[model samples]
Target: VGDALKDRFDGASRVMSNSDHETSVQRNDAAPHRIPRKDRYRFQLRPHNPDHKSPGVKDLVYLEPSPGFCEKNPRLGIPGTHGRTCNDTSIGVDGCDLMCCGRGYRTENMLVVERCN
Candidate 1:
């Protein structure tokens, strides 16, 4: 999905009309201004797959650049961790600190499954 979102910038698709903004700018006497150029949207992917030592956000959400991420071979879309839940007091990986990926994150109340014991 990250690739698809990026590709939308390189094509004339109506999926995102608000994306028609300058990707970069040039400098002129210390001032910068928009300059048209071939654009490429750099993206990274982190997947939550089974068999991996840590498959849940609680274990993988505390990384800055995610030292060991799979930019390729994504089993899930790149909406990425935006929709994943987090623990309020997560001192480790699964907190807002890492789950937001520095881009920050927003929250919403929703239904979740719990073990019925």
Candidate 2:
């Protein structure tokens, strides 16, 4: 979903109609500022198979990032805490897989699963 949203946004700007004001802007600065270059939407998933040893599902909470978080942290791949194989899979958190950050939980290389209350 995040990837799709990004594609749509990119496409819209590419075909934007040019008007007098639009064309008057400096060539380098002319751009739709709605979605900044430095932003990524956030989504999370919970593991269908729960791991008791890891953090209880009840204690876990998904901390949503601001509109531009992805852009700010684009360099960081899917959060390592979610699991070593997180990157191989899409952003789907299911079964034993827990996402630490929307991209990768804050902690590095640790998949933090909150206990489900």
Q: In model 1, state the lDDT of residue 78.
A: 38
- lDDT value, residue 24 of candidate 1: 36
TM-score, each model? 0.27, 0.13
After superposition, the stretches of candidate 2 with alpha carbons farther than 4 Å from their true spots are: 14-117
| Candidate 1 accuracy as lDDT | 0.47
Q: Candidate 1 at 107: error in angstroms?
A: 2.8
Query: Best by lDDT, which number?
Result: 1
TM-score leader: 1
Whole-model lDDT per candidate: 0.47, 0.38
Q: What is the lDDT of residue 26 in candidate 1?
A: 42
